[model samples]
Target: MTFPLRWLWWLPVLLLLQACSSIPTLPVAPTTTPVAGVQGMASYYGARHHGRKTASGERFNQNALTAAHRTLPFGTRVRVTNLNNQKSVVVRINDRGPYAKGRIIDLSAEAARELNMIRAGVAKVRVERLE
Candidate 1:
């Protein structure tokens, strides 16, 4: 088999474009004020991640009322209310992402417990940003 040497230059450009496209871009926090709230599935992480560093450079504390949101700015406070149990808790955004598909937020263990959703592991909830 024979390869075309003249076409080699185009290969690098194509590869670079592909690499750029495949790199996932983190969602940017909105510059303007956000809406009052949003409703979606919420989940929690604890124990295993408790001592790890978060995207915001803080240690993850399962007992703290903290949470991860896709684009909410770090230090933003939000109230998450479980639709099923009618329980709610305030959590500070200290990380980025739920990571899991279809989930809107990831909460700390204490926040999950406060919402009475520890057993279910996930819940449908309303998240209201607090000023």
Candidate 2:
């Protein structure tokens, strides 16, 4: 049996719409300045995420003291402060972002543990870009 020509045209349109809807919308431009009082939970990934290729094309290593930022350029270093404990650690940006809304950054598992946030699975923190 032959399909109708009209159905063929509609198939392309449906496929296009599906593709567009499936893509997540990213911010047009991300803020570079430090966000104050923007506290939320922070989590880390290791082992599984390690050695994987990052958005910046660098190999991810959980022990490397690296991080992911929504907007910061790759290789940019930032100081992450744990608001709950007042502890902080410097991390190099080597990847994209937390991807979850309301989360600021994604730190290596070691980094999160350093801030004493491993138990909580999250921490309130601030991220400041450094030169």
Candidate 3:
């Protein structure tokens, strides 16, 4: 059965309304700057992930002082200090993860070793963005 042509006009209006409904009302994230002395938990990437391409498009090196942050831009250098032993390491942001609750950064395996946290697997850390 065929409907009357009058319904054609209503069809376009309905589609327009549907499209407008699909638009997000707010942004998923907000504009922000990296805060100095952000404190949180830090972990490390293991040997299994070495040589993999990171989110920043660099090959992951277990021995290099590199790190992953949730929001820091790639190539941004930061000093990660372990609160337990007061050890610190400078690492460049080369990825984005930890994928763990309450974790702020993910360090390279070597960085973890330098921090004396490889055995513990995680540490309370203070992250200071470098200029």
Candidate 4:
């Protein structure tokens, strides 16, 4: 013979648990060796996003060899290699991003053009941090 009021107490707790589970987690950057760098789809910034202040507090330069990585520390340099064309460019990690699903890095427009990826907008690549 439980009171009806007792069951209502669990409703708020259940809702809170559901809400916690729905929140997304921040992406963690890879800490592997240079030879075993992270691998994923790489995207590039467009003209629309140029000149904005990046997470590192520096203005984004579309023509610079810079990149936005979810977890790499600002000022860290990385070598991004395009597996399709075997082209590679070294870029400094000055921002955080590639927030889109499954992408690991976002390159500046100049970096993408060096890799011949401007036409594709995205590429399959490997990222190795420079020591």
Candidate 5:
């Protein structure tokens, strides 16, 4: 059974609002040079995801010195240092996220190895953008 046509107009508006609500909002990153440094827990992606396409539209290479940052512009280079051991490795920002909570960056396996964090799979890191 059909009701009044006037109510039909509200359907499209409601649907559009629902759709917009579901779209995730990304944090606004600085268009200028990045700030001093970001300190947070970091994680890594490796062989299991090797060769997959990254958010930057490039193939993911676990061996490459690349990383995913939530807000850094693609191709931005940053030095990630493992706070635990003071080991650091420079990685290009090539993707989007760690997805997991409490993590700031996702590193390539090679970067993780360079930072000596593979054993723990995660580490407290200090990230400083490269000029």
Candidate 6:
């Protein structure tokens, strides 16, 4: 009986040791720097998604100067340039992503219009992180 009780106590100690060993000593933080010359398809969302709660919990405003970026942290400012018309607009990221596979950014309706991309629905643009 005493032998069994001793083994039970050691069992818990062994399990505790195993758990501690499994934990990583250090965790890595994700780097948020934007790659230079990153180009991709950009699109806009408007009345359909306006007034809805965004992932950041802010009310989505179609007229606001905001954008969605895949990897840029929220509050990052970027300059988006329309390659076709050479028009550019500065937008702040307030949301998580464009959600489309190949898209790197999603602009508000007004931003799209500013870039002269309202008709195309999608445009090839260059996104540069504003310092």
* lDDT of every predicted structure (CA atoms): 0.93, 0.83, 0.91, 0.89, 0.92, 0.89
Number of clashing pairs, model 4?
A: 0
In model 5, what are the clashing residue pairs, if there are any? none
Better of 2 and 6 by TM-score: 6
Candidate 6 Cα errors over 4 Å, as ranges: 1-31
Q: Compute each candidate's TM-score over C-alphas.
A: 0.75, 0.70, 0.75, 0.73, 0.74, 0.75
Q: What is the lDDT of residue 80 in candidate 5?
A: 92
lDDT of 6 by residue, 32-54 (tens): 76676688899999999999987
lDDT of 1 by residue, 39-123 (tens): 9999999999989999999999999999999888999999999999899999999999899999999999999999999999999
**Candidate 1's C-alpha lDDT?**
0.93
Q: Residue 69, candidate 4: how far off, in angstroms?
A: 0.4
Q: How far out, in Å, is residue 4 in model 5?
A: 39
Tens-place lDDT per residue, model 3, 3-57, is 8998789988999898888655865554444678999999999799999999988
**What is the per-residue lDDT of model 5 for residues 26-101, given as tens digits with 9 covering 90 to 100?**
9986565546688999999999889999999999999899999888889999999999999999999999998999
Give residue 43's lDDT in candidate 6 (0 to 100): 92
Between which residue pairs do clashes occur in model 4? none
Clashes of each: 0, 1, 0, 0, 0, 0
Residue 53 lDDT in candidate 1: 100
Looking at candidate 6, what is the lDDT of residue 19?
82
RMSDs, each prediction? 8.8, 9.7, 5.1, 8.5, 8.6, 4.0
Native-vs-model 2 lDDT? 0.83
Q: Give candidate 4 regions above 4 Å deviation.
A: 1-35
RMSD of 3: 5.1
Q: Write the per-residue lDDT of candidate 2 for residues 1-131, one digit (tens) a residue.
A: 98778668888888889888865787675456455445566778788898899999989988889988777778888888999889999999889879877788899988987898888878888777777
- lDDT by residue (1-131, candidate 4, tens digit) is 76788789899999999888866789976563234477889999968888889999999989899999887789999999999998999999999898999998999999999999999889999999888
